[model samples]
Target: MFSVIMYHHINSDDLPLSNSDTMMDAHLAYISDHFTTLFPGDPITPGSICLTFDDAYYDFYHYVFPLLKKYNLKAILAVPSAYILEDTEIAPEQRLSLKHHEIYDGDNYKTYAPFCTYTELREMIQSTHVVIASHSMHHVNLSEDSVDLEQEIFGSKVVLEEKLGYRIESFVLPYGKYNNAAVALAREHYSYVFRIGNALNPSWEGIGGLIYRVKGDGLKTADELFNPFKQMGYWFKTMIKMLKGSR
Candidate 1:
């Protein structure tokens, strides 16, 4: 089955929501070992591998881009258009501090740290290997904020298309939280929707599972990427853990 690997940060230090470089290398190595790397338009087969990252973080530009070039792989990056427009560059120290601390919270949503700037995003796009997508206006939780839901979902598409100068067809629901209304809203714009969790195949419950993914952290070694057994073990365990948590 086709498997999309979801990743976040690729920074040197381990941020709270980060995957260490060691883990990232091992994950990619495993792909090279067990499956052939496939592009967006490539024919799909069982065990096909596609890479994706949510929230255009600075580490992706700083760390992940080089690896992508080295391996000659293609991947997608989903970004918060408004945040990128602000052009905020997060330093390692600032990132660590936010991860360790709670920056803000309202209703049940929380904000942690700053993300990458539009400049960095433009730089990433310069690499022919990377494609940009939308994550929403402010990374807002669409499942609960029904009043602003229209703006959050549709507005993001407009912003991203304008900023990146391309039509964005993919999206990752922030926190993997959504309801019927949100889904209905998303269907109007996005062709593929990604949820956060570990599974070989994404949920086919609706338009949600068109793209399935397993999280890959950079903390593991590059060798792990090439080891099918190790990657499978991690994938299975992660899926089980997420299933149990959902229940």
Candidate 2:
């Protein structure tokens, strides 16, 4: 079974959405010891692990990037196109004040915690260890019918490709909320789509377009995540969710 771990902020601050750099390093070490790290397009195998970061936070560039290089592993970075296009810088104090989810919600996020810059992204991509994928154009919840599907869904792909000069084949659904319409729209654009949830993705079937990922915030330590009993709990939760037809 393969697992896709989801992460948000990787900062030293005590924020609700952040995991300390030390803790992140521990998680990476544990995964390196226990599983083969894989990227978006790589064939999923038993004990395969994929690390994905959401929101394209600057801290990912500040903390996660170097650690990933040190561990000699690859990760998928889900970026909102507007955040990169805006290219604003985040203040130290503001990083402590705002929740990670709030970073994509309002104008304050634009004024406060900045997303990764294009220059930084270029440098990171050159490393050949990072796979850039679309989070959305403005991080809007796509489940709403009033949403501009064409813009948020398709437009973001266009913007990222144009700016990054690469074919973005993967996308992550925002807030882990999606309707049938949203999924259909995403499937039309991306080869793979990721959702926030816990499940063991089996490799018997080729890696499907819709993928489920576990919440990384709940994992405070490597032991908390790697424990076999805890893993069974994750599987049980995923099974219940699937039975409810949620994922």
Candidate 3:
């Protein structure tokens, strides 16, 4: 079955949503050996897999990009446009608030890591193995009534295209929460909109709506994914969920 795997941070340190570089290497190696890695716009084939990274962490520049180059794989990066833009330009107070919270490593807590800069993003995109997509303007939950749906959904797309000088055809739902309104808004702006979940989509159909993604952040090794029984069990549960029509 085809799978779209989602990753957040790639680092050696043990932190929230962090996966080690070693484990990432293993995952890539296993995927390369077993599946056809596909890009966002590519026609999905049997046993195809797509890799995606959320949050546009700086660690992805340092850790993930090089490995992608080594493995000759392509991935989509979902970037929160506001974070890439000057923090002062948006909600300065909220930026300060988020910065105050630190991430805990295995031994000690440290200041939260920074997101990738524009230069870094350009470098990655130039590599031709990375596709940049919108995560949102501020990474807010689109389900909330208080949210400005136009700004969060369409605004991010405009910003990324303007700043990066290219059209962004894909989007990932922030927090994986969305309502009918949110879905409609996303459809107006992007060719693909992804959600956090575990299931495989028909590659030939393309991702025009809510595409499910399997979480890769918690995995410690490739073996966990390569096991046939585990793979079947995972798909079996997904099948049950699908039959129930549950998200």
Candidate 4:
């Protein structure tokens, strides 16, 4: 089965505002011992799990990347092509303090860019431990009719490929919001499309190229993930989402 765990910010100061480094390290350790960690394009088995970090936050470069190296594991780093800068002059702590949407605020881009820079991303990719996926161009909601499906779906693939020098085969719907038009257009451009749903998939094939990811950001510890109750909870949530038919 294919199961994906998604994360966002991993604060350096052990702050749980989103997720702390210590807990993430523990999670990496547990995953290394238990599941066979796979990159996006790799072949999978029953115990396979894909670890994905969304937004390519600075904390990821500072904290989680090292933990990934320590565990010798591979992961996907989802990047919003518009929010990313070539480089940032701000400190990691300062950038980590602001809300993700703050980057769009006037002159905030000059002060501090919240997302990772292309330089940083390139460095991570050099290690062969990371794969980049498009999280859309502006990270906007695709359900809105005013939004441009070409720019949000295919355009992001173009930008990331030009900047990062890699063929981006995956599209992670921003905010997990997408209409059928968005999905249909995405399938036309990319081989894999991802969204938020805590479930297990049989494999990457026969799923119409759509994959579901679980929330790994709110986890408190490795135990919380491995707990039997939590395991059942994931399945139950997945079933509920399946019933609702992906709004």
Best by lDDT: 4
**Given candidate 2, what's the lDDT at residue 75?**
93
**Candidate 3 RMSD computed on C-alpha atoms after optimal superposition onto the true structure:** 5.8
- lDDT of residue 1 for candidate 3: 50
Q: List the residue pairs that clash in candidate 2.
A: none
Best by TM-score: 4
The TM-score values for the models, in the order shown, are 0.74, 0.86, 0.83, 0.89
Ranking by lDDT: 4, 2, 3, 1
Where in model 4 is the C-alpha error above 4 Å?
A: 12-17, 206-208, 236-247
| Alpha-carbon lDDT of model 1 | 0.65
Question: What TM-score quantifies how close candidate 3 is to the native fold?
Answer: 0.83
Model 4 Cα lDDT, one tens digit per residue, 95-203: 7776655656876655777778999889988999998999998888999989998988898999999998988988888888988899999888888788877775556
- Evaluate residue 181 in candidate 1 and report its C-alpha lDDT on the 0 to 100 scale: 80
Displacement of the residue 214 alpha carbon in candidate 3, Å: 0.5
Local error of candidate 4 at residue 27 (angstroms)? 1.2
Candidate 1 stretches greater than 4 Å from native:
12-16, 39-41, 86-114, 202-210, 218-247
- Candidate 1 per-residue lDDT over residues 39-125, each given as its tens digit: 455677766677888877666766677777776777888887665534544454554444312322331111323556666677777
How far is each candidate from the true structure, as Cα RMSD in Å?
Answer: 5.5, 3.0, 5.8, 2.7
Regions of model 2 farther than 4 Å from truth: 12-16, 86-113, 204-209, 237-246
Clashing pairs in 4: none
Error of 1 at 22 (Å): 3.4
